[model samples]
Target: MAVALTPLSIPGRAGQLVSQLGDRAELHDVYDETGSRVYHDVSVRDTHEVRELVALVRRIPGAVLELAAGSGRLTMPLLALGREVTAVELSAAMLELLSERLAEAPERLRERCVPVQADMSSFALGRRFEVIVLGTTSISLLDEEGRAGLYAAVREHLAPGGRFLLSTVDIVTPDDPEAAEAVPEAVIAAVGAGGRAYRMHDYWPAGADTRTVTIFPAEIGDEGPVTVCTTTVGVLPVDQLGAELGRAGLTVLSGHPLPGAWRYRDVLLEVGVTA
Candidate 1:
């Protein structure tokens, strides 16, 4: 859902890592290291997201287009189900991993997975699909203008009667003093095989504003502390998000907390068309 920058290396080689690791390597080394592991953990404790998505795909006709389809986690399974999928991913490293994963699948399955490296906010595939999905809080990463651009692009590429599915993490508003105070002190976001732990914390520098400054600090085994990764994102409250999409000419069909989503809500929407 949230993108964390690559952490400082294993202490001794910290400088080497920063020097040798390019942007893509930095992304893979830290940001992407635990991508699949988290998915596996969630599938065991909660709902298998891919399976739930597969069920949804079964009801819709035509091809599937997944935005921000990192490493093809969802796209691969959709392809395995004999559905054609166009995966839009921005990270080259993620696309590479996705390609490697697809290669291991059966030929028929591999053939159905189309990987495209493009920004979701402004991608032109020149085709429409029955289903379009922006998975795992990808929408929250954007500002108002970016969100509008993404919705416009999605609308442009959505076929008649097609559905747009997405999930967003909850962001508390200052209007609710009690809920704002309930924000966690820290969350253990991920754990690696080598006993490393990635921790995340959120704070509001500008109260009442949806903008949040998130800090991700990691502990690499017993090695000394390293530099932390910081990112700022606009976290839209649920009702406000729905209103924004409505202004984009999208009608919210359903909005509810997904089974096992914890703090996220899944929304289904359709293009507002006048008959």
Candidate 2:
């Protein structure tokens, strides 16, 4: 299927660069087939919440279900815990990448992993899991309606005494709108595991309920073609998310702050079904 690419109107230095590139820019959604390659390339070596998330998973013992398990970033670690891990993903490209990684893994690790193509917002494996993880703030990728479905699906799949762990951004910086507006943007240069250098731009305005992230090659000559990927995700507050979970018959068990110094910090929330 040929996906029609839309013109991306970025809002920062990256956007300006795209404007200058004009016809040279090839825009893609971050999760698209081509862009997912770039995501897998960089994420393969990135470790943001692996330690904390795996530690949380270790406390509970049983089968694990990882939602939106792109390219098995956390899936491999979860399988390393010596448990059955079902990694569900929507992108076939990403799943292909994960399959490649697992193929090279030792039989001890590879055999325990079961890769399934499914949507995290709504899915059913006809069974329950002791630990279900939705990391990388992937929940924000869902709209309000989709998130409702995600919560419902989670509730249906949790075994008795099971825990659902997810990570999200928690704004902990300046409270005033003026101060927040002044320091809410960041541009980072990152090198992927494939040795490709990329410039990532993140911009979130004060009082806005969403943030935009755009990525492109860090070094681009005045050339013929350049691929740019961008994605916008909602900003979910802890209190709001807790309320939504409560309405869906789930409750927060605990919260752990991950290590970071961004204006908005990542908080891992452990949730369980209501009694």
Candidate 3:
């Protein structure tokens, strides 16, 4: 479907923008320990989430803006599908790795992928996109205030009729308080080249709070165990999410659960401007 996006005119605001989790040192060590190449090779590839996102993009013909495009996992794939993609990433390490990989691609493919080092919450590319995607539940990394900032940014960059999509691991509701409190000991987070592995563990605030902890424990090929990086994020329910979107002038058109063993899912939001 074709979209026509006209910049919205606000009464008071003339210029505005919005702005990651964990400290720089912690993020750098984590990504350095697990090279971007290995991370993409293991965590991305033909995962259910990636496939679902690809399918969604195929339906929309135009440019795409991918938020939190860590290491170009989704960016490269979308470019392969002949979509012009602008990837906004926070971690400098991640963007550096993405640039390295993109440099190796054929000129035609490389030209289509634009790598921008910027925070997802507040970035302006001076244009709108036909499709905007926030895969890997990256939005979960933000608190309530930050999420609103992100939604506002998305709205500003989204073309009229453009679609916004995102996914996350389901948060257990009150019907299952036990499920929310118990933290999983270890789960395979990623497996890089040469069988290197990354494990994830949930630590504190596992219940009731709008926030929770996510720690990544990586095992490099020969380095053994490296220091873990902890990221805190909000586990917003669907109702709350819908309300947030509404507040941002975005509306959910449909919601679909991605194919996976875990309760993983994504939602489609469209700018609901009445003619």
Candidate 4:
């Protein structure tokens, strides 16, 4: 399950949408069964971290453990590396989609992936991995305590001289300062891998601790049932995250900045166990 979920809400345009749909609106947690398909469809359309992540993984040689391996976005590419990958996920629904995708992959790649249904914050694989990944900024899904537990688990699961690669949102200070107020929220039209169009709404205020995201069908009528996926994501500043990692006995090795738009940038941090 998606951890420490803040209350889900449909505000602004999406709220107006719900008001229009009335009883016809079907609300779903983004990680739920029906929503997992939507997540998978959308994930298949994204290429955000695949290249940078795979490049880093290629330098490391050994088994891999992917946390919150939803719908096999990074899982598939990680398997393409020809190393044994253990994909740990909390959502059975998401894992189901991943399993189906793996079933259709080439026999060689199909045989290398091991999918396990388990929480990313707390899991015992009874083994270690050279590369332990928690991509998609998924570490933000957990609360403080949960993140601490995750760090401990990662430490326990890292092989000798291993590295833990994770990505988190990086806050960029604008030169104008007024740029944040100028863009409080944005709605973008995107076509998913399933060839369905969606209107994504992201409401993130400057310096806010959390952001609310809502997705709706690009073409929704008033009468029929409409599926709306929503979730709340917490923002973990790079400095704060570094401190947390230090407290957990993990030392930051290097940070690589990723390109992004709309007032948000992602940074992939390479960390190792503190000596």
Candidate 5:
């Protein structure tokens, strides 16, 4: 499927606006437009907690599968560590960037990683995995039925004694406030070699316990302004999440804060095959 590409933009402060987009494809484009330094800085500022989740998984063994692999940030790192990896993603735009990165990767690393374009809810590869991961709070993307189906699908693909690791925001916490009044932000920034810079910002209301992102692009060159694109996402609570997993026939091993008392968003879970 051909993905519609959109330029990164923000109305006022482009930097903050791009920060709000926060999706894999937009972030990848920002990295391509700026540089690794900017990308790393932004990642650290926005997703610092993900590092802890990475550390936790580093101790595990065998092939790992990442559902909704996005632009392959975590998946690539896993391959660099010599772990066999398979990625399943729904967005063609994100997967395209993932494929590009994989092409530039070392042959050995490339050998360890494979990308499959498919939804996490019902994709079947006819194989099981030692470890399966769904990152970036992917579970919340699904409705209740989709979430349940995804749990069953993950369980079906997990090898005996294997585990599934997932990370999500704990929306039930008091800090989240009632979802009706939340404002979502999306920010983008870029600088040209001529010392000129451009930025874009977008904001909108996301549903209850949800985040909405829009991208706008500003041209430092002779081009005009344009609104890039938008994507919406949802967040779920831990207790309700566990019930969903239970319905999928998986057992929870752990769900807690992600090591650093980061934001109210907790790691929320680890599930293993039921005996």
Candidate 6:
């Protein structure tokens, strides 16, 4: 029998809870280590995808800004391509890793890349860019209101003829038993590393659409139980996302299909400004 999908609720303490967990040094350390590993591995699996993104950006003329530029994966590579890249990220730990990577980056690449730590929803850098990219579904971290605010901010910070490129997973599909079961399993496998694993055992409250992912870390032998970190991600449908972007005063340029995925390759939006 197919497991009926149920809506989940965001805890009243959701934001505070994430804030508290993110503040813990030990937890942060583990996340940092795991994230670094993931990105390093992603470069291999997604090289073609990354190349496609870079090719698209290369077609746009001028400076580029990377929103939620975790660990500088795209930032560094774009910089190496001689593009002027400014990275904006929220996590201090991730930013620290980006900074460290920048220090060891080639001089030419370092000259092209700059890192800025800030909240993407309302960040203002006293400057604008011709191209803005929110990579790897990072925008989904925000709620509807927050997503709207972020789109507005992106519009506000775009230069004349500037374009925005956003990517995300499309989770809305005809209910299929095997596919649904595989979706969560694939996500868990991708995120599991360093002897740590995560599983989504609950999607509850039937109205909230909130998901609870439980993390479990264990040693190879006799290390007993390790810590578990639970995080929730907000779900937004493609139509809702498009409507939100439109509300922010942008025109859709393209919504391309991503290869081997149930999502769009990229949703490209253009905002007109007079420089």
User: Using Cα atoms with residue i matched to residue i, what is each candidate's TM-score against the true structure?
Assistant: 0.70, 0.95, 0.73, 0.95, 0.70, 0.71
Ranking by lDDT: 2, 4, 5, 3, 1, 6
lDDT of 5 by residue, 1-275 (tens): 11343334332344444444444234323323333223323332345446655665776788899997777767877787688999998766667767887899889988888899898888899999988988767787888778877887897899998889887766433355454244344345644334434343434334346644433434422333332344445668677787777766788898756643222456647788777
Model 5 TM-score, all chains together: 0.70
lDDT by residue (162-235, candidate 3, tens digit) is: 88877765543334657644533224466554565655443334443333222344533333333333334556
Q: What digit string (tens of lDDT, one per residue) describes model 1 on residues 29-127?
A: 222434433332222233335555677778787898999887666776778778889999877767776788788878999888789999888889999
What is the lDDT of every predicted structure here? 0.61, 0.88, 0.62, 0.88, 0.63, 0.60
Q: Candidate 4, residue 134: CA error in Å?
A: 0.7
- Tens-digit lDDT string for candidate 2 (1-275): 22454444577677787888988888887878888888887778878999999999999999999999999999999999999999999989889989999999999999999999999988989999999999999999899999999999998999999999999888775767676678657888899998999988887877679888888898999778999988878999778898999999999999999876457788999999999
- Cand. 1 TM to true fold: 0.70
The CA root-mean-square deviation of candidate 1, after full C-alpha superposition on the true structure, stands at 6.9
Task: Give the per-residue lDDT of model 4 (tens digit) for 157-275.
Answer: 99989999999989888777697777767898888898999998887877789887788899987478888888878899789999999999999999989888677799999999999
Sort the predicted structures by TM-score, highest score first.
2, 4, 3, 6, 5, 1
| Backbone-clash count (model 1) | 0
Superposed by TM-score, candidate 2 places the C-alpha of residue 22 at a distance from the truth, in angstroms, of: 1.0
RMSD of each: 6.9, 1.6, 11.6, 2.4, 6.9, 7.8
lDDT of 4 at 229: 85
Q: lDDT of model 3 at residue 147?
A: 88
Q: Could you tell me the TM-score of candidate 6?
A: 0.71
- Pairs of residues at least 3 apart in sequence or in different chains that clash in candidate 1: none
Q: Which residue pairs in model 4 clash with each other?
A: none
